[model samples]
Target chain A: MFDIVIVGGGGAALVAAIEAATLGKSVLVLSKHYPTQSQTSMAQGGINAALYPPDSCDSHIQDTLKAGVGLAKEAIVQEVCRAAPKAIEWLDSIGMPFSRKGEAIAQRRLGGATYPRACYAQDYTGLKLLHTLYDNAVKLGVALRSRTFLLNIIEEDGVCKGVSVLDMARGKVEQILAKAVILATGGYAKMYGALSTNGFGSFGEGVAAAMRAGAKLSDLEFVQFHPTALKKSSILISEAARGAGARLIDQEGQEIGGELWTRDRLSRAIFEAMEEGREIFLDMRHLGKEFIEKNLPQERKLALLYEGVDPLKEPVPIRPVAHYTMGGIDVDENMQSSIQGLYAVGECTNAKLHGANRLGGNSLLELVVLGKKAAQSAAQMEQAPQQKLFERTKIDTNFIKAVFALPNQIDFWERQEFLSKIMYHNCGIVREEMRLKGVLSVVRQHQKELAFMGVRDKSPLMNKELINFLEYGNMVELAEAVLVGAIQRTESRGAHFRADYPQRDDKKFLAHTMIWKENGVLCADFKPV
Target chain B: MKIKIKRFHPHFEPPSIDMEYEVDNAPTLLDALLQIKRQKDRTLTFDYMCRSGVCGSCAVRVEGKEVLACQHIPKDGEYIEPLSVVDVIRDLSVRLEDALVTLGSSKAYPLDMQKVAMNEEDERLIERQSDCILCSGCLSSCPVYESNEAFLGPFALSRVWRYVADKREQAKKEHIDAVVQNGIWDCTLCGNCTQVCPQGIDPKNDIVMLQSKAVQFGYQNPNLGGFGSFGLEF
Candidate 1:
C-alpha cells in the first residue's frame, strides 16, 4: 500500500506528487503512457499569469468569467486567479524556460484576455511547463509506474482506498492499495472522436470510474469547441496565432473575426460560417514570415505536415472542433470529490473556474494552482485501513479472445465514425432538440452494442485494442451523458448552444446539470454554481 | 503501399516474424498501422499517442531509418522494424525505461532555484536544448550507444548540457560530474543523433559543448589520453 497513488501523469499529477512528496508522503504515479506524453504537452499556447505591468489577476478573472458566460463561480475564479502568479513562480522554480521581456516574463494578449497576460516559452508553453514539472516530480523521489491502464477506483462504503490497473506491457492485472487516490485523468473531448484536440488517452475514464463508484458528475453538457483546428485533420492550431495577429477569414477570403474573439464566440462564428459552407481560414500569412518563424514555428510545422498548408504562404483551412471538456467530476476548492479519500484535479474535475467554457491558457494555470491545492488538502487527510480488498478475479486470456468474426472490421470502424459524426452534428457548437434526440437514440443503441459486444484482443502485450475498446465503452457512456445533459438544458449558454431556444435562460437553466448512473439508466440533477 | 512489420514474441520460434499488410490513403505510417489494427489485425501491438507527432511515442524504424511513424508516410514495399540497440518489450514497442531513467540522472532541472528572475538572452541559449521529448530516438540511432551501453547516450549528455548552459543551475559541477563514463569524450560526434531527432534538437553539438566544458574541468577520455600532442612536442 502506498500513501498516495496518482492515476495520471500530466501537470496535475506531478504538481500533486511533488507537494505530497515534500510533505513526507510516499507517492506513486501510475500513468497510462509516459508522463510527458500527456495532452498537457499538446498545449501550444502560453499560460496565463498577470505578471506584467498594468495587468492584474482580477482582470484575468473578469475575462475568464466573461468567457464562461455567467457560469463561472465567482469564488472559484477568484481563488484560481489569486494563485495564478504563484503558479507561474512554481513553474519557474522547477526550471520552466519561460520566454521573457526586459525585467519580467513576457505576456501576450490571448483571445478573451483584457491585457497581454499569457506567459510563454515560444509556442511550446505546455511542453515547457509539463517537462519541468515532470523533472521536479522525478527529483522528489516519487515512484512512477508507466503503461498501467487504470481499470477503476476502488471504493468501500463510499471511500476510495485504491485502484485496479491492467499492466499493459507485462499482460497482468494488479490491485494497488493506497490511502488516497488522485484522478488527474484528463477529459472526454476525444469522445467527440478523432475531431477532438485531445490525445488518444483523454478518455473520461476517471470521471466515469468514479461515477460507477457512486460518484456524481457535473456539467457533462459543457464541451468547448475550439475555433481553429486544421481543416482536414482536427489538430489544434493554437489561438496564439491571433495574439500574434492572425486573422479568421470567411470563404470569400475576407477577414471576418480573427484571433481576437473569445473562444465561445469564435467557435460559434466558425460553426455558423462552416454551416453556411463558408470555409474558415486562419490567415497568419499577413503576420509576416519572421514572426511566424520565430514564435509560431510549431503551428507552421503542424500545418505543413498534417494539413499540407504553409501558414506563411496561404491561409490554412480550419474549422471549429471539439476541444475542452468543461464539465466533469464535481470537486471542491480542495479538489476533493464527493467520495471520501478520493480526489480529482486538472481537466477531469469540474473545479468550477471554467464553469461552461474555459478561457485560453487558463487550463494550464488551473493545472498547477488547483493541483497544488488538492495535494495540500489531501496530505492532511488521515490514512485509513481498507474495509474491503479491491482485487480483480484474474487476467484471463479468454476475455482477450472474445471478438467475433460476425462484425466485420470495416463495419465496426464505420459505426464509430457514424457515432462521432452524430456528436459533431447534433451536440456540437450549435444544437437542436430534434437532432439531440436523434443523437441520444443512436448513442443509447451504440452503448448497448458496446456493452453486448465484449469484443477484445488476444495478446496482452501492449494491447492497444483493449485500451481502445475500454475507451470506446467510456466514450459511449460519456456521449450519452453529454446528449442527455444537452437535451435537458433548454437554453444557450457558453458551449451548450440550443438552436430552438437561442437565449441564455438564467431563470431556470443557470445552474449546472449533473448526471450519474442509477439502476440501468443515467439520472440527471442540478446544482447551483 | 505495402507495409511489412517485424513481429516478436518470447515463446514463439525464431522470436520474430515479418507480417505484411496493404494500406491506402493513410497520411502517415502510424495512421496506416492504426488502420491495419482497427480493420485488419486486432492483436498487433505498438506504443503511440498524440499521432500529430509532438508526443514522440510513435517512433519506429522505417526502411532501417529512425523516424516518427506519425511524421513518415509509408513508401511502397516498406519494411518497418523496432528501434535497434534496445531490447524489445514485444515488437516495435521496446523498453525505453533505462534510457528514460537516465533523463533525470544529471539533475538537468534547476533543483534549488527560488524562482529567481532571468533575462530573455539567458533563457534563449538553453532554449533549443530543452526541446527534447525524451523519445530516445538519438539513443537508439547512435553508433556510440550501440557499442557502449554505459555512454549515458546523446539525450542524457544533451540534458546535462542544458543544465550547464542554464544560469539558474547552482549545482552545475554535480550535473557535469554525473555524465561520467567519460561520457562527454566518448561521443563519436557522427551527427547520427542530430539527424534522427524529430524535434531537430542538436544533441550532437550539445555533446561537443559538454566535451569542451569537461576539458575545462580537467577531464578527458582515458582511452584517448595515451596519444600525446605530436605538434607541440615537435
Candidate 2:
C-alpha cells in the first residue's frame, strides 16, 4: 500500500505528490487523463501573491474577505494570504517562468484586488505553472498512473482505507489500498454543461465519492459566474482582458461600467441586462492589435475560433457563464476531511477559504499552498496496515457489471443535455424559490432514473461511453445537493443569489451549507462559522 | 457537413474502417465527433477535456495534418484520424503517455538554480518556448522521431531550451550535456515541428540555440570529423 494516493492529476495532486515524495513516503497519483491536461491548465488569468511594492498580505486578505461576502473564514483567509509569497517563491524556485518585471515577478491587477498582486506569465499563467509542477513531480520520481478513473473511495468504519478505480487502459476494476487518499479532482461547474466555462472532466465525481464515503460537503451552492465568456460557446474570456482596459459594452455601443468589479457583482449586472433582451459585448478593439497579440493572445484566439469575432478588430460577443465553484468537500485547516486519513485540497475541497465567492487569482494560489499542506499533514499520520477489505464500498466489480447489465430505457446523453439546459436556466446565475424547487424535483427524478441508464458500448478497453455514463450519474447526484442547498438558504449572498429574497440576510443565513448522505438518503443543514 | 472518421477498435470485427456521417450544426471537428457519438453511434471514442486549445488533449490529424480538433473548423468531406506517429488507443485517441516520458529523460526543467532576480527581457527570451502546450502535434510532425524513437522530440527539446536560456537557472551546463546525445544533435532541422506547433513555438530555432550552447560548452557534434577524414586514410 502507498503512503498517499492522490486522486486527480491537476496542480494540487502534483504538488501533494511532490511533497509526499520529498517526505520519503510512497505516493501514487491517479488521473483520468494525462497529468498536464487537468482543468488547472485552462486557468488563463493569474495566481495571487502580494510580493509587489505597496501591496501587503493584509490588503490581500481584506480584499478576499470582501469578495467572499462575509462567508470567508477569517483565519483561513489570513493563513492563505500570508503563505502567498512563500508559495510564489517555491514556484519560482521550480522554474515557473513567471512574467518578470524589473528583476521581480510581474504583478497585474486582477478584478477584486486593490493592488497589482497577481503574478502572471502573460495569459498562459496556469499552463506554465502546471507544466512546472508536473516537471518537478517527474524529477522527484512521483509515480503517476494516467487513464485511471476513481470509482469510489473505500471507507470501512468511518476511515478511508483505499480507493476503487477503473483502469481504463487495462479494462479492469481494481482496488488500490492506501494509507491516505487526497482528492484534487476539481469542481463541478461543468454541471451547467454547455453554459459552463469548465473543462469537460470537472464533474465533481471526487466530491461525490467523498460524500458517499461519509465526508461532509460545505457550500455546494456558491457557483461563480464569469462575466465574459463567449456568448455562443461559453468558452471563458479571462478577466485579465478587462484588467488590460477592455470595456463591457451594450448593443447600443454604450459602456455598461463595472468592468473592474468582482465577478459576482459584474455577472449580476450583465445578467440583468441580458434578461432585458439586450446583448453584451467585450470591447477589446481599443486595446489595439499589437497589445492584444502580445498580452491576451489566448483570448483573441478563443474569441475568433468560438464566436468568429476577432477581438482585435471587433467587439466580441460575450455573456456570463458558470466559471468557478466555491463549494466542495469541507476540510479543516489541516486539509483533512471528516473521514479519518482522508484529505482534500484544491477545487475539490471547501476549506472555508473561498467562502461565498472566490477572489480572482486565488484558486491557483490555493492549489499550491493547500496542496503542499495536505501532503505534509497526511505524511505525519501513522501508516494504516494494508487490508484485503474492498467489499465495503458501494461500487465494485459487481457494481460495474450490474450497471452494464441494466436495461437501457433512457438515453443518458439526452437526459444530460436536458439537465444542463434546466440547470442553466433555473439554478444558474439567477435563482428563485419556484425555479429552484422545480429543478430540485427534476434532479430527484433523474437520480431515480439513473438505474435504468446503461452504457450501450460494452467494450472494456478505453470505453469513454462508460466513463461518460458514470460522470452523468455523479452529476445527477451532486445536482440534488446543489439544488437542496440553494432552496434551503432563503437569503441572497455572494454567488448564491436568490432573486426572491433580493438582499443579504446575514442575520439568519451567515452560516455555511452542509450536505451529506445519511443511510443512502441525501441530507442538508447549516453550520455556523 | 459530411465528415469521414477513420475508425479503429481492437475488439471489433475488422479492427479498422472508414465511416462517414452527415452532421448538422457542427461547426468544429470536435462538435461533429461528439454529435456522431451522441446521436448516430455510441461506440465512437475520442479524447477531449477543455474543448479549447489549452488542455492539448484533442490533437488529431485532419487530412493528414496535425491540428487541435477543438480549434480547427472542419470542411465538408474532410477526413479525421488519429495522429500518425502514436499508438491509437481507439478510433481517434492516440496514446501520449509514452511520448511524455521524454520530458523527464531530457532534463527539461531547471535544476539547482539559485534564487536570482529576473527582468522582463530575460523572461521574454524564453516566453515562446514556455508557451508549448505539450500537445504532441510537434512529435507527430517530427521527422526525426518518426524513424528514431530515441530522438528527443520538439516539445521536450524546446522545454530544455526554455531552462537553458533562463537567467535564474544555474545548471545550464548540465542541461546542455543532457541534450547532446539523442536530444539536440539528433534533430535533422526538418522544420516540421515548427510547422505543426499550434502555439507557434519554434523548436527548430531552439535546437539551433542548443547547438550553439553545446559548442560553447566544448561539446562538438559527434557526427563531425576533421578535414579530409571522411573515412579516408591520410
Worst 10 residues of 1 chain A by lDDT: A392-401
Fraction of true inter-chain Cα contacts (below 8 Å) kept per model? Answer: 0.73, 0.77
lDDT of 2 by residue, A250-318 (tens): 999988867489888889888989999899999989899898988898888888888888887899999
- lDDT for B53 in candidate 1 is 72
Q: Which consecutive 10 residues in model 2 chain B have the weakest lDDT in total?
A: B225-234
Off by over 4 Å in 2: A393-395, B226-234
| Best-fitting candidate, scored by lDDT | 2
lDDT (Cα, 0-100) at A21 in candidate 2:
97
The residue-by-residue lDDT of candidate 1 on A336-455, one tens digit each, is 998898999999989889987888889999888888888888877677655454443233233334443224333345567788888988899899999999999998888657635544
DockQ (C-alpha) of model 1?
Answer: 0.67
What RMSD does each model have against the real structure?
A: 2.4, 1.6
**Model 1 TM:** 0.96
| Tens digit of per-residue lDDT, candidate 2, span B1-234 | 899999998877999999999898866888888989999899899999998898899999999899998988989999988987789989987889789888888998778777887888988988999888888999998888989888888999999999999888898999998898888888889898898888899999999999999999998776564554577633
Q: Please give each candidate's TM-score.
A: 0.96, 0.98
Label model 1 with its docking quality class. medium
